[model samples]
Target: MRIRAKQLAFAATAAVALLAVSLPASADVSGRAVKIGVMYPLTGKGATWGKHAQIGIRLAVEEVNAAGGIGGVPIKLVEYDYQAKESEGITIINKLATRDNVLAVLGPCFSSVCEVIFPLLERLQTPVISYCSAKPGLSKLSDWAFRNSLTSDKQLAPVVSRWAKDYSIKKVVIIHDLEDAVSKAEGSKVLPMLFKREGIEVLDILTFRTEDTDYSAQITKIKSLNPDGVGLGSCYQNAAGIIKEARRQGLSQPFVGGACTGAPALIELGGKATEGTYVSTAAWMDDPADAIQAFVGKIKARNGNKAFPYSAPRGYDSLLITANCMNDNGITNEKGDLASDREKIKKCWANVKNYPGVSGSTTMNEVGDGAGGNRVLKVVDGKYVDISG
Candidate 1:
C-alpha cells in the first residue's frame, strides 16, 4: 500500500511539471505595458494629417485604457515625428522595431514617407499600419506593412465616374503634383485610367511642384484647353490653391480631385471657390450612423469645433484593430515572446475583414490596402456633402 501511494504521488508531481513546461512562459498580461509605436509627420508640410491622426489615436488609446486595457495591461505609445522626411521615417521605423520593441506601429502618414519605410519592414520584422498613406500598391512592398486607408485609385474611381456624368464632362485637363508620389500617381496613372473607362478625353496633363504657391500658369493653360472639367491629382492645400486660381482666371469648369483633396482644409482654404468641386473620401463626416455621430461629436469637442479630417477615423480604427489583434491572438506582451507576438499581430492584420468602423467597413485586401466604401463628396455652401448615392 505504501509503495502504491508513493508511485501515485510521483505521477501527480510529474503531470504538474509537464503542464508548467507546456504553458506559455508568461501570464496573460505579463508586461508592465503593451508598447505600440506611432510615427507621423508632426512638424512638416504634412502636419495637418499628423495632428488629426494624433487626436484619433489618443482617443482610441484613452478608450482602450479606460476599458481595462488589453487583458488588463495598459498600452504605452512610443511616438516619433518623422517630419515627412524619408530618411527620418526610415530611422524612426528602425528605432520603433528594435529600440522600443513595440508590438506594432501606426502611421508615417504621407505616401512619400511610407514608400521609404515600408520596404524596410521585411528586415525589421515589425508590422506597420498606415492611417493615410494612399499611394496605390505601396503596401505590397512588404508583407509586414498594411494600410487602414484606401488607395487613391479605389477612392477616386467611383467619384470620377459620378463627376463625369453629373457635369457632362467629355474632356478633362489633368493637373497633378510633380513631386509628391501619390499626387503624381493620381494625376498620371489613376486619373488617366479612370477617365479612359468613362469615355472622357484627356485634353492635357499639367504638373507643378508641391512647393509652388502660384498656380496661375497652370490655371491659364487649363483655361486655354477649355475642357469640360479639371481633374486634380493633388493634396488639399495645392488642390484648393489650383481651384482658387482657376476661379480667379475665370475658368468655370467643374473640378474634381483624388483622395488627398477630400479634407476639410480644401473647402476652408478655397471657400466659395471650392463650391461645386467634387472629391472622394474614405469617410463621410455627415454619416447618420450613431457611432459616426458620436465620433464626430467627440472630435468636435476636442478639436474646438474644427472640421474633423478622415485621418481621424482611420487612425482610430488602426489602433482598435491593433488592440483587437493583441487581445484575440494571446499576446502576453512578454519580453521573450516579442517576436512571436509581432508575427501573430501581423497575421491577424492580414486577415482583417469587414471590421465595422466609423470610417465604414474595413477589410484588408490581399495587397495590404484597405477595402471599404468611399464617399463622393461635393463642396456645397462650405461643407462636404455626400453625393455618392
Candidate 2:
C-alpha cells in the first residue's frame, strides 16, 4: 500500500510539472497570438494602389515576424480582396469579424467605402486602421474606424489656397471626376469656400466620370471659362488623362493639384505632356531621411527603372505603424489568445508617440487620425522636382 501511494504521488507531481511547462507566464497574457484581417483592392481598378499598400503591410509583418513574432506567437495576416466596392468591403469586414475572428482590419482604400463599412465595424466593436480613406466624416462615423492618412482638408485645401495666393492667381477652375466620392467631396465642400477665402473667382467647376477618358468636352468647357489655373482633385489616372487632354487642347496655364498629381503614373503615362504640372503631395523622394531614400531605391530596383510614386511612402508608413503597434503591445504567439490581446493592442496604439515612420513623425490625434504634411513637387524635365513652397 505504501509503494502504491508513492507511485500515485509521483504521477501527480509529473502532471503538474508538464502543465507548468505548457502554460505561459501570467504576465505574458497580453502577448497572445492574433489574426489581423487585411482587406484591400488586390484586384480591379484600385489593384495597383492596393498592391502597393499590401506590400508595405506584408513587409511590416515580415519585419515583426523576424523580430520574434509579435509577443512570440506569430501574427497571421488574413487578406480579402474587396475589389474597390463598398458592399464587398463590408462583406469582407463582416467575415473577418465573425467567421475568421480577426483582431483587427487594415483597409478598403476609398473614403466612400470606409464611410459605408465604418458603421458595421462600429456595431461589431472591431478596430480598423484604414490606410487611405480620408473623408471628413470618417472620424465622426465611429470610434472603431481609425485612419493613418491625412484628411484632404489639412493636406490639400491649405496647399491649394496658398499656391493660388502666391502665384497671384485671379481665376481658378476646379475639375474632378464626379463619379469618385473623394473628388466630389473635395470639390463640393471646398470649392465655394476656398474661392471665397482666397478672393479668386472660380471661372468654372467641371466634373467628368472615370470611364470617360476623353476630356475634350471638359477641356472645351474649361477653355471657354479661360481660367489662369486649374485644380484637379482626382486619382492619378484620371488626373493624367485630364492633363494630357488639356495640353492637347492648349489649355495649359499653371495647373496644380493635390497628391495624385505627383504620382509616377503622371509622368509615365503622360510622358513629356506631364511636364510643368505641379502637385501637393505628402511625400517627396528627395527627403533627407536615408531610410526613405533607401526604400525608394529598393522599390525602383524592384520595378526595374520605374519611378516611385508618392503613394509608396503612404503604403510603407501604414505598415510601419502596424508593426510598431504590435511591438508596443508585446504581442506574441505563446499566449495564443486574441480577444483580450486585441483590447490591449488598441490601448497600446493610443499611446504610440513620435514614432519615426517613413512619411514622418507618426502620432495619432485624440480621435485616432494622422497624416503627414504636404510638399509640392513639379514635373520638370520629365521628373518630379521639388517646388519651394
Candidate 3:
C-alpha cells in the first residue's frame, strides 16, 4: 500500500510539470513594448529632411509614453535609413514587414522612393504613412498606403488659381527642372493646365535642368517676356538660388511656387528676396490651434528662436496621427506580434476621422489620404504668414 501511494504522488507531480510546460510564458507575450518601423532618407539629399521627421516622431513617442503608453505597454521605435534610394526603401519596408515585424511604417520623403516601395506595402497590406511625397496617383496606389503629406494638386492648384484669377495675372511663366520627378510628374503639367483653366495665359514656358545651378540665361529669357508672375517647380535649394538671382537681375514680378519656398533654408539663402514668396502646403507651423502652437513653441525653444523649417511639421503631424490612430483603436504593446497585429491597426485606421493633430484635424478619407485643408503662407519679414482667404 505504501509503494502504491508513492507511485501515485510521483504521477501527479509529473502531470503538473507537463501542464506548466505547455502554457505560453505570460511575461514573454505580455507587457512587452510595441515596435513601430520607421524608414526615411537619412542620408544623401534628404538628410536634413529625415532629421526633422525624426524629431516629430520622438515628440509623438514622448506624448504616447506620457499617456500611459498604448495598452499600458511602451512603444519601441525601430528605424532604417533608406538613403534616398528606391530599392533601399523597398528592402527596408520588406524587412520591417517580414523580419522585424513592425506594427506600421512611416517614412520616405521623396515621391520616387514611396512610389517604388508602395506595391510591396500593398502586397503585405501594411499601413504606411508618408510625410512629403504628395504624389496625386498615390490615391490609387493601394488601400494600405496613407499619405499624411499634402497632395500637390489639392494643396497648390486651388491657391494658385485663386491668386491668378484674383490678380488677373494673364501672362505667366512656368519654369520647372526637367530632372525633378515631382516637377516632371505634377508641377510641369498640372500647374499650367490649372492656370489655363483659370483664364490665365501661359507665356513662354521654359525648362531648366536640376543639375544646372546657373539661372541667368533662363531669367533673361523670362524677363524678355515680361510675365506678370513666375511659377517655379524647383527644389528649395534651387528655388532660393533662383529667387536670389532673379532679384539681383531685377526679374522679380511676384514669383511663387515650389512647395518648399517657406522653408527656413530658403529664407536664409534668399534673405530679403524670399519676402512676398507664396507657396501652399499641408500645414504651416504657425497654425492657430492650441496644440500646433504649443508644438511650435517647443520647437522654437529647442532651436533657440531660430525659425523651424517647413518640413518639421510634416514629421510632427505624421507621428501625431500614427499615435492617435493606435490609441483610438485600443492597440497595446505587442512588440513581437506586429506582423499579426497589422490588420487590426489597418481596420482601426478606417475609423480614424478628424483626429486633431498638430497639422490640423486629419480626417482620413476612403483613399487613405489625409483630406485636410491647405494653408497659403506668404514670406513676410522672413517669417511665414498665412494669406487671407
The RMSD of every model to the true structure, in order and in angstroms, is 9.7, 10.7, 12.3
Give lDDT tens digits, candidate 2, residues 1-389: 11111111112112223222322322242434557888887776545667767766676565545545544555678998898777898788899988887777888777768878888865676778877766666766777777777777666766666667656788988887676667777776755566678788887788888677788998888888888888877777788888888889887676676543456777777877777776666666688666766666756655665665544556656554554454444444233456555665566555545555665655667777774576766778988876655
Return the clash pairs for model 3, or none. none
Clashing pairs for model 1 are none
For candidate 1, lDDT tens digit of each residue in 149-230?
9899888999999999999999999999987889999999999999999999999999998888999988988888889999
Candidate 3 vs. true structure, TM-score: 0.84
Model 2: what TM-score?
A: 0.85
Q: Ranking under TM-score, best-scoring first?
A: 1, 2, 3
Higher-TM-score candidate among 1 and 3? 1
Q: What's each prediction's TM-score?
A: 0.92, 0.85, 0.84
Best by TM-score: 1
Where is model 1 more than 4 Å wrong at Cα? Answer: 1-27
Q: How far out, in Å, is residue 334 in model 3?
A: 5.2
